[model samples]
Target: MTVLNEPATLLNGSAWTSHVFLGEWTPGSGGDYAVVEPATGKELARLGSATPGDVGRATARAVDAQRAWAAAGYQERAAVLRRAGALWEEHAAEIEEWIVREAGSVPPKAALEVRTAAQECYEAAALASHPVGEVLRSEQPRLSYSQRVPAGVVGVIAPFNFPLILAIRSVAPALALGNAVVLKPDPRTAVCGGVAIARIFEAAGLPAGLLSVLPGGADAGEALITDPAVRIIAFTGSTRAGRAVARLAGEHLKRVHLELGGNSALIVMADVDVARAASAGAFGSFTHQGQICMATGRHLVDRRIADDYVAALAERANRLPVGDPSGGQVALGPIIDVRQRDNVHRLVTASVDAGARLAAGGTYEDLFYRPTVLADVPLEAPAYAEEVFGPVAPVVAFDTADEAVALAADSEYGLSLGILSGDGLKALELAGRIPSGAVHINDQTVSDEAVIPFGGTGLSGNGSRMGGIAHNLEAYTETRWVTAQSELPEYPY
Candidate 1:
């Protein structure tokens, strides 16, 4: 029923729109909203919003579905999740297009997001039938064990950047573990994160009412976080938003997992190849227009080679093509919205005013900001101290290895760090000194895999992993201990 070459065949009418509940595309009962494509500054879609009442309804349904879904056993869940993975691959192109249109991601970035989403589904499927309980030793004639059981309902609130993969990273595991989900995708990229994922899972035979996608702004997210029936809250966003989510979830005493913002650093030692290090630094700082949380905002290099590395990096940044994402040839796309674009510009301006030299670029046309590189950056500059979340890299020169380690560790956000050194031992030594969630040797800061414990420390996260099997321990399930006694024993009753 589908042709391989014709992508238009997949984009029928409203097939990619995702405001759903109880396995149906029900209309929203709250306010109406519209999203503009940053690439062209044109209205992409007009969608409905969700109210607190809608949250109540979705919460009740999630509670009901979670009970039945958990009772279906792992085999049934695995089959459904595997089918969802296959469906995701089958519709990869359409999903890629949605990501580009909705999130202002370049072709390569959009493709990676879709690919990662599919992989997450398959990986989660493999975990479906795996062992979840462990046997415990007992002294008396009794058997004791502990098993992981599903948390009742999970509320997933995803950010606009990397909307598909970040959302799927949490959604896949939650579904595989038999927990119902109430997903609140960012209003900016609801088409990809909300509509596309919901359709795939529904087509893959997921039970009705098991997953709900409500695309709205802060009000909807607040409703989802505060809902009484939602037992767990998994959020990925800015540090400010994550703190708010944590506070609200705390009020309800709900289990909360957050993957917040990051101001990652990429350190180049004196022994490494300056050209190669600069290339990696360019990619690390400008990928997805540097919207990624793990993107390197600070470039700390040995002063011996700082000038050469900065020149090479600036050349790479200036040479990168920037334009509309739909053209499919640009390396850098537009920012998510006017607000974000202005925020990035303000930081760039302030950093330059505060004694940082604009080595490459600090300009923009509409929402498209050029890949910017700053040299001689002071420690107090916003470009050095905060998470810019834009295509900006501030280079800071360091004298000794101790200074480099301390510079990298000085950030308030400790999500990820990169070390490029010819000496492996030296790189490992530096990595050991940095306090971040992930440290990569001889690589860029922007790296993620489906099977690793991806998250952060400090303000970057709230002591919870977002990916790998380790995340499921805190996010999707709870542990319960059980004991069987062959003979009665006296107790302090």
Candidate 2:
């Protein structure tokens, strides 16, 4: 267990050393990969790439045990998930530490995820036990009932950002519905997510082959996706990668749920509190170094408020504490790697050269890029059109309601959008008109459960991961209607 040793050799869930070409965590195979400390140029863990063989074994294990698991009644499934939830609550501290270390998240942010996973487990357990379809009323003596059954074995491909939370969003629902999960975490930060799954499943007394985590990169993913035994695929990653999965899954006619890229916007109106709105908007765009899919990338402010709001936002950006992610006061940490830092720097430079104004930071020091805020940014600039997965937020001014809505909705990726306005009525109006999957009024966009339906219309993703009743229905469901007649007709047409 990870609680026993922080530097323990990474496990492939079921065993210690990897058995290559079969579901195992082989050390140094596909490519020599290293887990780096985001704040420092230090290597914490070295891993080998997951070969095709590893994927075959993992998929086989999940497929082998899927039928019996699906046969297990909802009551039994709920009971197991309840135990897993209790265990997750008990080991929150340990899980949080691993998450922060491997994923580069602040301790506080990581702790919340541990709590969130437990809550999702409980909610999924409740959802699993409840009957999905209802009885219908008819004139003829007939019976009708619908069942929401598991989609057989599920393959989860988790991302680096919010590993545990993102992983749990799908896995818990899969488990509660009595589906076996073969999770392939982001190779760079797999330990934390893998450990959490291992601990929860063990505590829940799940059958050995019912759940397993294989930490691998592309080769591993390709193997799993191609396997015919895998009935369902849940992926969270880039649009390019998501497209590949969609194509591959289409050929096989396998079910897939994708949560892909984002180039979201934040629109601030003239009536809002300039100072507070600027601060909130800056944080939303730059938080986690802007690596998250829901992170705000585009900024649209009313022309009357643009200049003053930009100044306030710059000042607020300067106030953010920068240092190690593990510290208490540090709100901003270094980017995940030098490659991302260089990419972000290039994006900022191109924006400035293309006529965007640098309102605040637009410089870099090694892995840390200063929190950048750009003004007078045009949609023509590359930064304006693409998803900038970094700390730079480009701002553009708008005068009319039509102009403001047009600027925010201009991006091809429509993941999430935030709005700030004093007039709640106007804010709601704007929210309704925005083209993205979710809209926030008088505040920055966040992954809220009860309030918004989080997702996108086009390049952002094909499906929503978490939200309200629709999300629950989408995750684990199959619809079929039955028509019955009490008086049987003897004549056949």
Candidate 3:
């Protein structure tokens, strides 16, 4: 293993000779691509993009490694993961810095990502020794039981936003369940998501070839998905890409888990604290430049207090500091790239053209877009109708509870929703009416905990849960029933 004295230097414009891992860092036969820092458009490194052949070789290695990994038993697996989790905490500073530099994550958001990743590792470790089988009673058989077995190799394709944590959320669970994984992280945050994770696991004494990190674009993901050795695909990205993965994996009859895009809504009821709800809306809509899948895309406020809520939200949005992530003073950092920035601006401009009044911000300085608030946005506007994954919040007024529920349920994506109301029972009632995978009461839409079933419905996902124990049991395992007869009865013909 190549150990650097100052591992933080890896984040600075260092050239990587390999991207595919098979027991070690193996050079890719494909072309190299530059890893551009989204915050500054500077070249952090040039990483080799894996070709189809490279992915196949990695999959074969994983297939071989999975057998011994499964037989290693849960106790051994738990030890390795616990060590990996400790390593993650030890290198928290560097990992946080990498997230900010590569993915343009703000300081606090980056730190949270690191913290969450480490916590996921720890959480996954606990699953290693947990009971994975159940006793069964049969009518005729002497003994009957069902056992949960690993799904062999799992393919993990993670997105740039919250890359490390998202990847860890999938990878750790698969590993803990005794499945070898080949991860293809988003090319944008390859170092933080790929290299950093590989090193940590390798140092923690995980068997070589058990886990591989390949940093590439769509080609690598397609290669992993199509490989026969891969039994399951755990994907977190846009709905378009998730659909493609689902379709392809279906052809092979392989299991797939997707956590896709969401246009979550934050509904402020008439009896709630308008200022607090506005603050929650602002944070939900603009945190991490609003790149989160569960970030609030629409603010549906009661018409009676709509104006007051809009004013409070606008004040908070305008007061937020926006600049380079390295400055350590900014709450909002740059968008992922020029295209993303342009796409966000286009949506905002189109909403304004459709008669939405911009109340706070509608401007950009370089890649850093100011937190924007638009009030009285029509339902048909792109900001309200689609996933405008930028630091923009479009507020729409609703007259009644039914109208609020209708507005929230009008989206094709049903990942998450936030309801703010003084009455807990009312919020609970409304949460039940919304058809989303997760509903937050008295809180913002953008919330994730490792212990919860994290996934989505409809276009948001394929209904395969990630995080939590249920996801671990479902995504990484297959059930097998075993029956034994103490005495064989005479064959009746």
Candidate 4:
């Protein structure tokens, strides 16, 4: 383990210890909120909270700054983004410590988050040099083309789980495409998500007021979405919250992108190695305490090998170490907070009462919950039906491929799906039948890359992806048709 550094020191040794980073660190009007360490239930720091008025002020400044940012040359923008990426990598260790302490992530997960965030910046930097649009044929004897233009100010609201990656996925691309951003990060993980991002960009030579970090509550989030200056909204969180955001953004006629909740499934075939498949299942369901949106919520196993698979998964679950991440190395860390822990426990208890066999664990010590495995989980079981969002794996047996497909497709969420089989073609064939944003063949549900298009279908998202050059351009910019002719076009007057 490495020595942990204070966030204020890690943030470029500035006096930005305040909560809100709106151009500069200023005391917010929403009063102060305690930044708590979930692992120890201790107060890590006290920071000012942003109110709705602060959100408005941030948006106003962003709007003013966006014009100049958009006017800057592409190379200048790219340079800023590239420098930010280097800064993220340069401060990886310090950032990881903040994530572990503030976001309750284990060391490895924290490192992955930092790496992914850096990759996001690097990928976005490339977008600055990508072709903006296409030339089209016109019928009126004129040269016509369409070009991509910035969407002015973008409002980004991110969740606590995988905070840095989720927020940067949108922020970097938007900034690279010449759009200013007003961010509202979950107050629980604001230091890692909001302040860290602001520091990196500030050090990378981003002009002041182009990005604003508001560590705030729902009021601030709502204000960001409703602010007329914010023309685009990028939100990642639960489906319930997404619906509200979408509704409000729609009313304002603003373009919005959502990456919401998911109850994804992983299918296991009888032909593969039971232990190996079980290992994949455990990783899919237990990584970062299964708090990811793409976490495998339900396991659909072939009936022939269901029993063996369940035993193997339970064995893996039982051996996993659970404790505070900051204390030492542990396989699993504490849940985000008491409310989330109580919900996870409620779902587990209800599932057991509904006849699901508790194969391994169904207990916790404070916020540290043991990795749990439940076999013979009925379709109607609460844990199986809902998004557990915890270290709970519920297994259900399917007799045939058709039954497996049906079981896997039962959820309202179509975020991600996984298929495990010895035959590649068979797995590919099964994947085609499932309508998810991402399908992993012979792999787990939890996966992401900087260049890949990532989002979901149905309740998972709004059919808008956050990665890849084309997708990023589409999300952060709009297309405009322009025509050129030597002289004014002749028309019947």
Candidate 5:
């Protein structure tokens, strides 16, 4: 293990020492690619990129390593995860710096990501000691039981937004359950998403070849999904990309766990204080520049108070400062890149052109997009209909609770939802009528816990959950039924 004190040193070390870890520090056969800071648009570091051939090689090495890893004792595996958790906290400052720069996260958001990632490691450590099997009654005088086994090599594909948390949530659990991992992080966020994880496991003394971090493009991602040695795939990204991954994986008869896109909604009841409700809505739609999969894309307010709610929300959005997070205090950071910024601006522009009122924002200086609010937005408006993935909130009025339910359920996504009301019972009943995977009463939509089962429905994801002991067990392992008898039973031939 090597000691690295600075982000630059760590990245340079990773580039020179190994492009992709395959049991040892090894250079990539593919060429180098530059990493640019989203906030400043400056080249941060140049890392060696992995090609499809590199993914194939990594999967082959992972298949060989997984056998030995699965044979290890549960305590040994648990120890590695626990140590990794401790390392995350011990190196929090350096890691947070990497996240803030590489992912364009505000200081608080970056810190939260570090904490959540550490919690994920600790939770996964506990999974190693959890019940792995069940005993069943036998009718033919034989011992019968079903036990969980590793799913061999797992392929993890993580997106750019919330990179560290998304990648580690799958990586830590898969390793704790005795499965080797081949990770493909988006090339733009490769260091924080991939290298930081590899370094943590390396320092925790994870066995060689058990984990491989290969940052690459779609070619590498496709190779990972199609690899025969990789038994399971855990993907967190756009709905389109997830569908492509699922299609390819299905063709190969491999299991895929997807956590895709969302156009989540936050409902504001007429009974609540407009100011308080607007505060919650702003937090949901503006956090991390609304780059989260669970970010509130729509705000459904009772028509009687819709005007007041929109005004309050616009006030909050106008006050929030958007700039380079590394420079000073700011409420929002830049979009990941120019392309994403253009997309966000395009949606806002198109919605306004189609008669949606721009209540607040709807503008940008370079990549720093202001927190935007669109009121009286039509149902068919692009910002209202699609997942903007930006700090833009589209507000639509609903006359009754039934209308709110209809408005919320209209989207193809059913990831997360929120309802704010004075009466908790009414909110609970309303939540029940919605089809989202997770719902919050009197709160915002963006929420996650390491111990909770996290996933979505419809186009948001497949029916697979990605957290907690039971869900992680299901995601990373396979169940096998076995029976034993002292004497051979009478056979019918």
Candidate 6:
């Protein structure tokens, strides 16, 4: 195995850090993680673990840098991001490799993420021009207007599922709103984030102190929240982790934006095509190997048609090529690693052991698990009850619309939902009744267009992202009522 002594340099103008200063595990500590090539079980790189101290230093730099960056004014700030976007586009190819190598993301997905990163920077730069608040109406009582200002420094703790996308979602918004960012990305996928930042910041001419990236494990995340300097925290991960981040940030009275876990329920009524529902089911559950938080895992089908639906879905799923991600024929890649593969395996085994009939795939082994589909799996089964974030799709038949609604709303997570029904009007009615963040009548969950506020209800997330709700301004700034026309208080009473 080859160890890159100078993995890469972090740039803040001409100065650079040679070795990774972000608290990597030392040789003797025995805390080493590998980034493997998914196509072949070959080890690509070995990374040192990140310590808590590294988190503190990174947080301090981001917090301290915010003052100067916020003071740089709109024009200077915009110029930096603009340059960063240009550089990112120029070096997009190298960044794509980092993504595929570290996160094991397929080429199509990785390339799209790289392009999206550039677009995010470009979009954020544009947002810098709009004043946060303006005069809505002017009347006699008093001059009333809301002005948005910086929320100090923001702490972003992201996940590995879609490293580039999640990082950009948090970083771009915070920066556009004039908040200095201290980002703690997934330890397993730090290289992707680091290189992306380097390209954008290098091109944009952003002052060094404005952005700080510290990549490590959970301890680094905890440090970012506990610090007094970080006034806001934006996290995307498991429900357990989200809660901890929220609790810590609350202690400091900081603003928090969280996108936690989810287990989506895709409903299909008798009105829609069984083939269509089956098609949607395979794409939703198997895409990304079911790692996405918003992926559909539960299928609440109309009782009269459940059997046919499951059969067609099985056929569709089995037909899709599942193997090495590099092959053009394969639509789905292997499970991230043995860790998640095992997790899915355990859940399915318990469900079967508990008396739930296994309908399709029961095959599970090293590195990858075959596409899993479970039927006659009761609503109470662990696979059904909890988030089955794997290539598992369990279909449960429901008699009436009320039953379907109840089944769909069974989980506390309200991330994203979809319904397949011929009647568009009925679909809309059902969507309103079911409590999810976003709903689609004829399309699948990944059918997310760039324009909507993509988030969930209850435990899914505290708020939304994307889709012009790009009020990232809210996350990064504190609103202050500006009184241009000064007047003394009428009475102290």
Per-candidate local distance difference test: 0.86, 0.74, 0.87, 0.91, 0.91, 0.72
lDDT of 2 by residue, 426-488 (tens): 878877877787777777865645222456768888855554445655665556667666777
* Candidate 4: pairs in clash: none
Candidate 5 has its poorest 10 consecutive residues by lDDT at 1-10
Error of 2 at 201 (Å): 1.7
**Pairs with steric clashes in candidate 1:** 18-195
Residue 107, candidate 3: alpha-carbon lDDT:
85
In model 6, state the lDDT of residue 488: 66
Off by over 4 Å in 6: 1-18, 21-34, 46-49, 136-143, 447-450, 464-470, 486-493
Instruction: TM-score for candidate 3, please give it.
Output: 0.96
> How would you encode candidate 5's per-residue C-alpha lDDT over 164-214 as one tens digit per residue?
999999999999999999999888888888888988887788888889999
Q: Model 3 clash pairs?
A: none
C-alpha TM-scores of all predictions: 0.96, 0.90, 0.96, 0.97, 0.97, 0.89
lDDT of 4 by residue, 331-361 (tens): 8999999999999999999999999999998
RMSD of each: 2.7, 3.7, 2.1, 3.2, 2.0, 4.8
Error of 6 at 251 (Å): 1.9
In angstroms, give how far residue 115 of model 5 lies from its true place: 0.6
Please count the clashing residue pairs in each candidate, in the order shown. 1, 2, 0, 0, 0, 8
- In model 6, where is the ten-residue run with the lowest total lDDT? 21-30
Runs of candidate 5 with Cα error greater than 4 angstroms are 1-18
